[model samples]
Target: METVKLGIATEYIPGRVNVGLYVSDNGARLIDSGLDDEAGRKIARMLEERKIPLQRIVTTHSNADHCGGNAFLRKRTGCSVAATKLESVVIENPFLEPLVLWSAFPFGELENKFLQAKPSEVDLIIENSGIVDESGLEAVPLPGHFLDMIGVRTPDDVLFVADSVFSEELIEKYAVMFVLDVGAALETLDRLIRAEAAWFVPSHAPASENIVPLAEANRKGLLRVSEAVLESCGEPASREKILQGIAGRFSLSMSVSEYVLNSAAVGAHLSWLRKRGQVAPVVEKGVLLWRKTR
Candidate 1:
């Protein structure tokens, strides 16, 4: 097994996103690229310092903060960009289109200006369980935070788990998480815990040698969110009403944008519950009411 040098980029406050560079006989294969031009420049400099030529750039997901530097690095290193097939669409587009950030939240204007899409084209698309012949690294789909998320497992026993789990600090500060599919997220975390790996490197926090504990904590947090939603409704409530109640409970205000994002997350959870026959949705007075299935 080859010993790979790992570099972490701490873009967000207090939290670091791990972007792995697997250097082997062929060249350097990057695991995940951080958001924006700055991150790309940093990675480029790291490669330059080591005199390693970047051969490929593999992203674990399409979220802005994770794969945001794809375009920049591809432009700079001329490396092919690889991502899950489902995420290729998001990366190519890179924006929450048709959803006006300004009209949606309190920091609408700020989000609108800063959260605009930084679209990039994909050079390679990998399916779930597909092998990425990145000169020396293997990338596999992990799919939890988003439908098309992936994690790269190098020969050195390191698995780059992107945004599927976070540290306690991030969990508390970013109380509200952006998830495309809650059930999938839980399942993905479970898979990560079971997968054979020496280190679980998440894109938003420090890497963990043992991810089971953190995974358990995240599962409990998710359950807490579900319970809070159920209790706030008092009765079966529409998505909007449930979100409003959740925001009130957290002392957080919901903007239109926030509501949209939150609804998508809640809807994913509801979908999962329905699948497990744990919850059922009904129409009451023309409003959709979600109730625990009996």
Candidate 2:
């Protein structure tokens, strides 16, 4: 239902999941694929229609939505996939994603397409923040959304910021975005605001020439969510109770999938607060309870 932007050497495909596309005389490169095989098939068709050979896929993270098309595209066009070392681990072994969310062997509810993408091989592992490949694309470290997440800078100076910041509209719709580290995510938003770039393309947001405003909005959103967590923890509370408080605060109706993701987000906030000496957790009678300490 969305159209891929054309008439430029580098432009992002706009959809629920935006893909950064770069085409040169040599071959075409994509910043990320999309949700599943269907999305991958469409990408392959687009490149085929242009008679452009697909070269490498630079994956930003290992999230199912981000890397789901990896296997399909690689199989269809034989494109090499690149990602950070830790992300590559999950990209190749996707079960770990559901495993971490479930905190153990995941149940059937957690084993779905959104959480478990088809296994895809990662040919290149981005080791650090610099030129990722011979194509001259640079990798900028963007921690917090996922472990070892990095935004890619194309040669055209377009920054494909992967899941680091939410679009204002998305922020309004879902006030609390999923994050693995509240502290690191806030720091990343600040970094994005300060970074110099001709354009910043957030995966779920529109591309913008100036990203400071969007970055700041995301910062405030995260802060608000963190504050909500504190408000819920005036007294000792279990993780479920804390989640319930947050849901009521936001009036969110969650399915099981949303529950696990939001639960993880709550855990991240607790960890951040605990690190800052704002909250402490105690296991009393085998029931973990969190209480505000500061």
Candidate 3:
């Protein structure tokens, strides 16, 4: 066995989920399992090399890439899984609307195939600003990507920022960033920037010594998109119209599957904006119209 190690498991080519295994005198703990059985097996192999017994698996959030390996790892090591309370339900029931699922570009069928939520329960439901009592790790509340999203910090000041920010290549290639709550997402970025972390390790991308610049860029991009939505409507527009306008404006060349995923991402953002009082929606003629509230 290699002992405890920090490994980067690439879920998509050039896109990775960072897994950290903590081996100590007592047991071993894993932070952010990768996206499937294969990924889990790889991590297990690494652990076996280190001769460490896996004891706990903690996720920064419930996104598929972050938690998909949960079941496989749990079955292998019998480690208890834990996540923030807000994401437990969604993680357990990963279904998205069919339309939204199809809207996702490139990998549309992935929504149908992989969007099925895995059956894993959170052994520990972390409250807001709660600490995860695992070896050399701290779980901090970081809600933006998802309602119950969190960041795991190591004693060395390595903060595992899960989908909070992405590499420049990912941004350019994906064109559209998936955010459930734009406002909250920005706020969370601000929080992370202000925190005292030496390295920002994103689950789906490489770590950066300084993430503030990228975070700022992403924030501006989101604000620009929001402004575009407001301008296209001229007046308050329905949620559907706003989404359509966004797609048109971005010139997104999406297949049916991509379209569904994109729709879900837009819907999630709109819902977040509504919750934050940044936007308001009115039902008109059996359709929902959304407008900037503030």
Candidate 4:
């Protein structure tokens, strides 16, 4: 991962999951760690080369990819870790992630590192939005992709928007982005549309001076998925059938892990639509089915 400077006080390492570096009086704090021990070791080497002391790690969310390196980083540097409540739980009990996804003790494949990180204790639980004085970073709530995900806004005006928006190329490649709450995701996008920052950093996407277009694209993507879910249920289909129709339309070839993640995402779309009175559920032959209601 290469570090790009946003300001004297702020820099970030760009990768599949971007990690923000913020300098404060105490020491250098990382916004998020990368995937695992290897990622943690690499980041530690980078910091050592620069002669920076690792002091704290502020995680955006509990996604394994985002916080997987926390344990190694903390072991290496004794850095304090901070995260929102729900994410904090998952961080502390990594196995809970796969449990939530599979709704039980997950199968062997579901227990992969992609779904669960090594447990890392959180030193700080961000109870409210605004400046978190410990690291001199502001916590901007950006819920949707995961439970209680937040973005970090640096003093230098660089916003680390964690998985709130994905690039157009990412959309074309993956077709469906994982989200836990489609309604909250859309609301977060709406909030981002009016936000201004010197630079906006989305974990999976490239940083940009303007994120409005990206936000709009996310809104469109969510709407498109919602519409697809609605259209796929023309005949009152079960959740599995709805998923099959959506996957077929997108021509998505998914592994078991990918299928479960996508199924959760599709379930979010259904919940959003149902909440808005755009869809309804029925019990047919003892199986739950969903149908569009205009």
Q: Which runs of model 1 end up more than 4 angstroms from their true locations?
A: 1-16, 96-116, 253-259, 283-287, 292-294
Write model 2 residue lDDT over 1-294, tens digit each, in one string: 345453357778898889989887789889999989998999999889879899999999988999999999999999999998999999999999988887998899988889999999999888749998777889999999988899988888888998998789988877779999999998999899889987888999888889999999998999899899988889999989999988888888888888999999999999999999999999989899999996
lDDT of 3 at 277: 71
Error of 1 at 82 (Å): 0.6
Candidate with the larger TM-score of 1 and 3: 1
Clashing pairs in 1: 104-255, 104-256, 104-257
For model 3, what is the error of residue 164's alpha carbon versus the real structure, in angstroms, after optimal superposition? Answer: 1.4
Candidates in order, TM-scores: namely: 0.83, 0.97, 0.81, 0.97
For residue 237, give model 2's deviation from the true position in Å.
0.3
Cα shift from native, residue 289, model 4 (Å): 0.9
Residue-level lDDT of model 1, residues 173-263, one tens digit each, is 5456667677778888788778777677777667667888888878877776777765644577777777777777767666555566666
Report the poorest 10 consecutive residues by lDDT, candidate 2: 1-10
Cα miss at 50, model 2 (Å)?
0.4
lDDT of each: 0.68, 0.89, 0.68, 0.89
| Candidate 4 lDDT, 238-269, residue by residue in tens | 88899888888888888888888988888898
